[model samples]
Target: MRMMHNFFRIGGVAADLPHGWIDKCLDFCDYFFTGVVEYQKLITRNPIFLEWVEGIGIVSGKEVLSFLFCDFIL
Candidate 1:
């Protein structure tokens, strides 16, 4: 990840991977996270929301509103 970040920083453009790489990466992520979600379900023995937010730490609704609308005023 650091290497990819540095590559983009120096190149000043998005790095294009070979064809099918994006799809493969997405597939792998889906598989791995699916396993994690299943394990969480088994361990917790409870139903979970299919869509949920996590790790959105220390966010203020007012701050978000201000930031979102700040450009409109300018």
Candidate 2:
């Protein structure tokens, strides 16, 4: 959890994700760590959650592409 908070602090600066998004991320992380929320129900009710997952994939793809070219150059 401490590592997650630190990652959020650094990553949030680069990502500029909205407060609501950050709140949801924290809530999801809390539930994940605590096992308080049922995974199936959360997924069924919150469609935005899928969007968030997709967005992460997009960001990660961009990062990977950049790194591939960057390594070639360096």
Candidate 3:
């Protein structure tokens, strides 16, 4: 109940939202977008990020198959 809030049901929500909550959510949405833009400017535009991530996840088909079929129990 603590995690699920007990206000959610199979069909829909079991309770109406509190007053002013919608405005708060809308404000957060705007703030979150600005934060995303700021983060992209700081991280995605950095040359080090490209150098760090380039050629990082290269995987062969044999490695993929071995990983998929490996037995982990020992």
TM-score: which candidate is best? 3
> Per-candidate TM vs. native?
0.36, 0.25, 0.44
Superposition error at 4 for model 2 (Å): 26
* Candidate 3 segments exceeding 4 Å error: 46-74
Clashing pairs in 3: none
Which pairs clash inside model 2? none
Over 1-74, each residue of candidate 1 has an lDDT whose tens digit, in order, gives: 55755566654756678899989999999899879978887656644443233444567877777789984653
After the best TM-score superposition of candidate 1, give how far the Cα of residue 44 lies from its true spot, in angstroms.
9.6
Ranking by TM-score: 3, 1, 2
Q: lDDT of each structure?
A: 0.70, 0.68, 0.83
**Clash statistics: count for each candidate:** 0, 0, 0
Comparing 1 and 3 by lDDT, which wins?
3
CA error at residue 5 for candidate 2, angstroms: 28
Worst 10 residues of 1 by lDDT: 47-56
